[model samples]
Target: MSRYGPRPFFPGLAAALLAASVTAAPAVVTDPTAVTVALAAPVAAGMAPNCATPPALARSVSAVPWPQQRYAPERLHPLATGAGVTVAVVDSGVDRRHPQLAGRVLGGTDLLDPGGDGTRDCVGHGTGVASIIAAVPHDGSGLRGLAPAARILPVRVSEQQVVDGQGTGRTVAPDDFARAIRWAVDNNADVVNLSVVLYADHTAVRDAVGYALARDVVVVAAVGNLHGNGDPRPYPAAYEGVLGVGAIGADGVRADFSQVGSYVDLVAPGSDVLMAAPGQGHHRAEGTSYATPFVAATAALLREYHPELSAEEVAGRLKSTADPAPGNGYGAGVLNPYRAITETTGGAVARSAPVIALADDRPDPALVAQQNRRADARQRAVLLATVGGVVVVGIVLVALVVPRGARRRWRPADPN
Candidate 1:
């Protein structure tokens, strides 16, 4: 598959991101060109070896990423920090050693390796996605997840890696993907984020999504990054209950590679998006896969703020509160985390007004009657006041005119 990397935020960072090579432990990317490996799926995890060779470590970046400045998730801390919410990351494994993710990740299930929890990341993709949703904030580092207090349940299902210019990694089969989702839901995950995308829709995957929805779990998936490659709809994004996400750049427009379709329910900052690497430091990447986490993170905030809300209600709240961005495949709009948590859904907050759909332009009969009553009362009061004022003026005029006429009654008034 032919894939392109996203442009860097600054001209100087461009060379570092698109570098020819990098060196690190067995779990990171080696060739910088292969960092976009998130888009390529070559082998199945079921057929591949249990162990994975790490690629190169991600490059260190100190500057605050654009997504952080745009979303300003910190403002939502007073309202909701995703407390008591569990978000399952159904992607590559998450590295528990990251300082930002410490104490926030749960001992999740790893379908690839049953002996260990889902904390080990081989491709570094899952680690980045996890950080975006729940990485804790630290000094000297502007990078932090949207819901820092939310617990992460890592469901390691893919060990995808890139060797040389081609794709060589172990990803889960369609059946395994379904099992992964079911495992997350069964493990009591409030929200499930699927950064992984499959081109074809599988019956097992569809059924799994339905199962999650039935269990009242908010499921989010990427719409895929194959806009240039025929723009095929990806599953389980196209699945009925999934919140399909697309990628947007700093300009708040759709990323060039993000797929477009009715399946897309929302868009998020994905182009040149910053993420925590498997071991240490941060790097920039882009794709609908990256965008999926933003919505998932917002779901976590909603779940925390409104524990009474169902999975579908949380999803609906997000869609209804998003900033309006019309057409060109920009879903409902950019994900607004602060509004998602603070906005009222006719619940305790008492914020968002009810949207009454009018079948016709005519006014409501009850409201019209109420307005008519108010108008009639006002008209009666005004008429009485007008009559009183006219009577007073007439009496004053008659008194003045009659006195003046009496003074001039004896003879004709002098013409002066």
Candidate 2:
């Protein structure tokens, strides 16, 4: 297995990665060339051993033998899917044609028109991040995304680390990022995933992040992959409104290259994370870029169950409910979608919302008729399916509908 480390956001910070695990005590990667892996320990009340299977051959927990990847599935898979929440993936666009993602991508814009696509990925980083949240995977390949039912809005940007044919490393300006944030919020995206980082004290970036916060849109960012040097906070991740995510290797310790400190919010599986590449098939990549999506996807899942919690509150819950306590670089704790989505505390907060807030407003007969027509269609479908001894869980499988003209790169995730 070839492991290419993500480029550093700062100078002199080399990326040294191995799968870290918490199933046991912390283990460090001595050989950078070796493909290190830390298999998820059998779900129990103990630690994960450092001697588990490697990522090169590790199947998703869903494919592993009974109880291997199984946890409380009932509690983990919520009846309420991420139907209403939309996630804007401001990265290298997405494969709209992927089965798992087909029909799920909402409208998106291309920032790097010269070398980008709303559906193409050059380095495969954006696709990997998108899959972590929405990829249903080609069956039996053993890749299960954290939020398998969430919808994504693929926002394209250049590879900050990669150069073009002319050999130019593009700079992701603060204004570009701010525009993406507002676009996500304006377009009904409940969450925004920023998988890249910049180390600048730009006021424009702050205002953009603050804009999302004011709108109650949850924003999650990659903490950054570059340790050893003093941890200078990475952009958006270091920004106050965003939840900065870190990476945990197989030993369950923070990766040598993962940045840390107060800016960190949570951690996730960052080493050799498997997902759809920019085009097709599966590939593995390393860095906090991948970890941030897990947090973003988990937030969507949490919203499906806790709809009223503001994005900030959701971030708080994620940090509060994370597993294995955070460390020098891993923030509040490791990311655990299974726990955060189903974990419930305190009496449920209920807001009193009236069906109609205006008494003098007159109803539009045409609009009412359209709504009635859709309602009738749904009712008939339910009745026919039930009476004929058949039923469909179509609406339950997703919270959002896959409309036409989604990302042009759509691909069905279901191999079947």
Candidate 3:
């Protein structure tokens, strides 16, 4: 009945718990050269395969998701709606036919199949990710994207989450996964959202991430969902320039499944978060994958409003403007799109001042030290001058007062 033949369902694997609903979890792309990252849960028997059938269509939702409500797109859009920016979703294919995604998706590359555009979503992960970034509001539905005006460039690299069993759809090798990142960059993507996670680091993937960063592209990725299973270091999240993201629930605490590590650069709403389904509805999903888009969308907004800012500068702004971290494992803190968009670099409050040029938060230490030395010199000069003036005044007073006291015949001077 299924494409992968009737394989015994492995209930012990971590994927089995989330098998019913498709999540933004990373799909392991098997290759001889690439290191294989096993699922977070221990495999009792053989590795667990993808679902027997594609995910069912999610029911339409009218209630505004908690992330959306918390970010309050109404307030953010007035400032910047992520206009004139393109965010590449490097994950499973994105279903561009969704009502909310209409006119927002571009004809992107599909590494899996070269003939077709990257609009077909068999796994439904990319669509939800795209929705969080740029899906437009429609028909009074409360569900809308953080950057509705931004365009999505989908790069379909994997079709299913299966690691051992290759299903009907082909999964690209790790090299091709590297190629996908290059493709997204070549296509002029301003921001790239990587909901996919890999436990083991690979040279090809690491190099590709460096390529994107070299080109000034903002790279946002999930830290991985393996806190229980040793929380192996995940990449491209752990890559030097990549913005490693962790997930937090509505309660503003790190999700139990979200990996805790030094790589986590920021946290966003990930638990019980709502996302746009493939066909025509929404699904309640949670993962570092889901949380990745919120930061990606915020990056989109930042790029839209401040086009001159380099990718690293934009990332700095996002981190600097975030709310206070609840505790460890929560990177800069929860993703605050409003603050990310409205605040200046180094956490300075934005005002009605005319826009001049972008500020560099990381001033050169040498230059700073030099300025400090100059300031100290000026302060010392001013202090010396003041002391000299005080000494002169004291001498003048002594000269005048002594004479006045003698003239007063050793009596107290009278007030005149």
Best by lDDT: 3
- In terms of lDDT, the poorest run of 10 residues in model 1 is 16-25
- Give the clashing residue pairs of candidate 3, or none: none
TM-score of each: 0.72, 0.65, 0.71
Candidate 3 wrongly placed segments (more than 4 Å): 1-54, 161-169, 347-416
- In model 2, the runs with Cα more than 4 Å from the true position are 1-75, 114-117, 160-171, 346-416
Compared with the true structure, what per-residue lDDT tens digits does model 2 show for residues 123-164?
444566787787664565566666667788877664432212
Tens-digit per-residue lDDT, 156-249, candidate 3: 7766544343223345666677788978987888899987665556577777887777667889988877675556677778877778888888
Better of 2 and 3 by TM-score: 3
Could you tell me the lDDT of residue 275 within candidate 3? 71
How accurate locally, in lDDT, is each candidate? 0.69, 0.58, 0.70
| Cα lDDT, model 3, residue 94 | 81
Q: For candidate 1, write residues 1-416 as lDDT tens digits.
A: 11222111011222212110111111232332224333222211111123445445454566788899988876988888889889999877788777778899899988767766888876667777888898888765678889999999998776654455443444556677788888897787889998766555567777788777766788898876656555666667777767888888899889777878977888998777777766666766666767888889889998877766767678888888888785679777888888888777522212233212213465444334535755776799899999999999999999888888888775676899
